[model samples]
Target: MEEKKFQPYIPADKVVPEFTVFSVILGALLAVLFGGANAYLGLRVGMTVSASIPAAVISMGVIRFIFKRDSILENNMVQTIGSAGESLAAGAIFTMPALFMWAAEGLCDVPSMVEIGLIALCGGVLGIMMMIPLRSALIVKEHGTLGYPEGKACAEVLMAGEEGGAKASTVFWGLGIAAIYKFVADGLKLFPSEVDYTIDAYKGSGFGVDVLPALAGVGYICGPRISSYMFAGSTIAWFVLMPMIALFGSDLVIYPATMSVAELWADGGTWNLWSKFIRYIGAGALAAGGIISLIKSLPMIVRTFVAAFKDYGKGSAGVLRTEQDISMKVVLVVCLAIAVFMWLFPSIPVSFIGALIVLIFGFFFATVSSRMVGLIGSSNNPVSGMAIATLLIATIILKATGSTGASGMVGAIAIGSVICIIAAIAGDTSQDLKTGFLLGATPKKQQYGELIGVCVSAVAIGAILYLLNAAWGFGSEELGAPQAMMMKMVIEGVMGGEMPWALVFTGVFIAVAIEILGLPVLPVAIGIYLPIHLNAGIMLGGLVRLFVEKRKYASEKEKNDSIQSGILYTSGMIAGEGVVGILLAVFAVLNINTDISGIISLGNIGGLAFFAVLLASIIFFCNKGKKAAKN
Candidate 1:
């Protein structure tokens, strides 16, 4: 047997046009578009897919073909900068929405635009700065061992474009289709974006599916296993837990619920029961899953920390262009500056002690996140789980110091938000670095591109977030903001004495048992946490993927093309819906007449019919992708 040796597609000494003005502008624009799209999707569905591949495709189309730029390095740089927006958006949406939720509840004033932007800016810079030091150890030393699947796939897309062999139109096709679909469904209100059914006999038992293109794309991209795990969790929550509560606890009044279980059922339906009670259980599971994942990664985390410091103070002056990164000294200075900002910013709500937690956990999670994404793709990286753990610890520290109430909760979320962004961006940086390494691009240049994306994205994300909230509020039916809700619960549980510990502990043990069964717990826990309809929509997409994979193909290339086409199309769907969703939010804030519900009134039955049509369209597109790949 022969051992396969590692080789980069491009030689290390080779240089090509990379850091161009066109690349930076295009990438920055993409970052805003994708970031805005993802902010909408994550706020609605609690999951955000990677933008690297889609950005690569779009870069190829506009930068290579349209502008006649023949540089693969330029295309790579475009994706590197563009994808940072999605990564930063992911981190921000996961935790920052809690502020809006709190404001709605009258606990605190809504976080100002400046406050939001600064928090995102600080976190984005820290992530890029932290990942620069670990580049050699993770992206270089661990090369073939850690596949960095998304990065490699992105590189392949760039290379294909350079050779004039890449198919970029599928992405645009899906994007256009989905944008129109979203406008019809959400903007004109032709059919409800979500369709639900309630069982009259089984009081609290209800089922629903969000008929949105972005979620369907998410499911197909995530595939059967992960989607099923999530759906299973949703099933357990809706089918078993909610029903049991309705059966036995009918006479009892839940703490969070203002009335008896029966009365709550009549007033708010199944969603109220899950939000007030079952959501805490999901939070417990989420927290436990995060801790378990952290403990499991302890050895790796320790080794990473040791390796990082061993290279500390090492200058990049004499390194090869491809291996060059920002110096350790600059990283240290910037990190210290961020720490001072966190402590000094009154809007941040962090004291010296809180600042210390951000420093310690921020770097720690950054390392873990970057490496973990290398092993498993970013989609499965569990950034939210890590954020949960951070919030738990930070809230505890603040509570122990007597910083309790709304202020304390806000501070804890602020700290967690920065850490979340750090972890998310670090993972994204690692992936981009991997892509650069394979393509023989300058690491330092790419790092700068990432920073550029972050700055541009941070400015835009605050406005996007405020727009979405102003349009439909975070916790409303339109934008559930599930992950932020979990963070809010965790902080409240720690600071306030009104937490539902029984349900939470039940969720914790359930997660433990699931892990004992040798399953990935985070997805399942999230599935349980999210509404059944959302999970069901994702499950439909996963099933489409399963159907595609199960079929026989003429050759491996053909099979791969089919899968690639499905991914490209789905990515477009996510982006398309996101763009339109943001636009609809704008129209909403302007108080435009969007209620076409009466004119096109489908009601629930029509919604269910339209949802089936939506599912069928996904299957059709996937199969069409397979055929296109075969051709």
Candidate 2:
């Protein structure tokens, strides 16, 4: 018996305005906006938010309210394009900033903007092209099985376009509120965005939260389970490990720390301890988590790849519009062309061997990336861990081939960067395609939209990277760039650079213990890697979600509607804060001091008050959803 076909919201016979100039222009603007914003967030906190839903909501608000247009396809196109910026930025930030860090130490020249653009472009294009062949298998064939949470949520958002700004109000309110909050805390210097208190009784310990709106937004989006795991990791690091070090190694000078534990604690407190010691431990755990995740994903990755090829050309161009994809032959040729380009591109540092590695590893990981996002979501996909795994092997391979010193390290990072972008883009592309599939969008057009986004974002990202570095050095307090730092250390470690090995190994064992205990390693590892304050903020957000969920609902529909509203609201908060963050970076680069706090400074108490109001807003919108559901 034949399986019943899955019908989409827009039927194949239906036609609407899509791929319009307006959509392209809007998408381009959003691509730059979200791309730069995510880059800022990634550099600052070593975390980022997805742009798909935000883009969708904003597009809908404009199309339905501003322009009086009612085309869902056009709105979908905007998000498809806009979201690409975020994915590519994620990949680049995870690896490319290492070059900037290395240059700061005079290990090599600062990566030229052209060099940055070329690398990013190569990765972005390759990620899209590599994942194109898998759309049918991963998206259509595996439909109900995959779920693609964010994609489905995005589709629902587009579906809600008929209701106009009624739904978009949550997003708008969130955007406006968060932007004001960020400007007040960071710009006006009314208060510090990050608030902390040292625990006197618990020496070498502290409790704090970055009072910025985005961290709470992230917690709401990521939810309590993952947030709790991260909080747990941070808890152990700040409360358990730091005090232990202070107690046992009080008089001893650690290898990485020039001063004794007591002196370091006195000098910069627990923060100083974290910078010198906890970072390496976190790096090890992050590396271990990436490998564990990849190892666990191996069978599914292989299955996804095989299934993709087995159904490669099915339902593509020759079939219904809803099923149409770029021609397989075209996808193959473009992929090959990109490979050749990588080899010939001097700035990229890839040889013929390097190009082959790019194609092989690029597609392999792209496959893993797509499948992993399908089962889970893009947020949980550990592209950094994969990059670490790639760098370790790529570095050794490059070293064995006599590419040593600065040249070899650069070459290895180049390889890792492309693969990292490929994985990131692949996951993002899969999500976008899943949304398209559900909404009856043309795969070919969505693919083109993604390409446009990548190209535009690839160009803009270079400038953003340069601007941020000029404002605050990569490893500075303002821009920690943890993933990039990890990438740098991994490459340097392979190349015999100075490092504290014991601490790193201890982190590796910690990750192993986490896995043995059947807990998720990556988030826990990330928690350990980050400052406790940031984790605490995220925990607070998670607590709000817990509150929303714990309440008795009139019905499941009311509950879901309420939760959805909070998600949209928080999504806006992340983007709003991120945009302001990049703006502040721009101000810093221009030597324009935006701080007026000297006159109107709000202390920690005020910052706490603002954060409370921000969380309350999420609940308010959630309650609005309950009302909407009742209606």
Q: Highest TM-score among the candidates is held by which one?
A: 2
The TM-scores, one per candidate, come to 0.80, 0.84
Of candidate 2, the 10-residue stretch with the lowest lDDT total is: 309-318
Question: Per model, how many backbone clashes are there?
Answer: 2, 0
The TM-score, computed over Cα atoms with residue i paired to residue i, of candidate 1 is 0.80
**Residue pairs with backbone overlap in model 1:** 208-533, 209-533
TM-score of 2: 0.84
lDDT tens digits by residue: candidate 2, 1-631 = 1113888888987988889999999999998887887887788878666778778877887988899898899999999999999899999999999999888888888998988888899899989988887786678767866666567767766775554476656766777798889888988899988888899798989888889887787677667887798899999899998999888999999876778999998999988888788877876787777668768856655675565555554535356777667766677888899889889977777878778888887887787678666644575566886787678778878888888999888888889999999999999999999989988898889999999999999999999999889988899998899889878877887788455778878899999999999998877887887788888998898899999999999999999999988987776676576556666755654568988987887788988998998899899999999999999
State how far residue 148 of model 1 sits from its true place (Å). Answer: 8.1
Model 1 lDDT per residue over 1-631, tens place:
0112445666666777899999999999999987887888788878776788768877887877798878899989999999999999999999999999899899999998889999999999999998886776677766756666567656655664565423445666667888888888888888888898888887789998888887777777667877798899999999999999999999999776769999988888898888788877876787677667667766655675565555544665555666666766778889999999889978677789988898888877887777667754575566887787688778889888988888899889999999999999999999898888878888889999999999999999989999999888999998999889878877887787766668878889999999999998767887777688888987888898898888888888777777777776666676577557656644544557777788667776776776677667666666666677666
CA shift of 176, model 2, Å: 2.7
Q: What local lDDT score does residue 159 receive in model 1, on the 0 to 100 scale?
A: 61
Q: What is the lDDT of candidate 1?
A: 0.80
lDDT for model 2 comes to 0.82
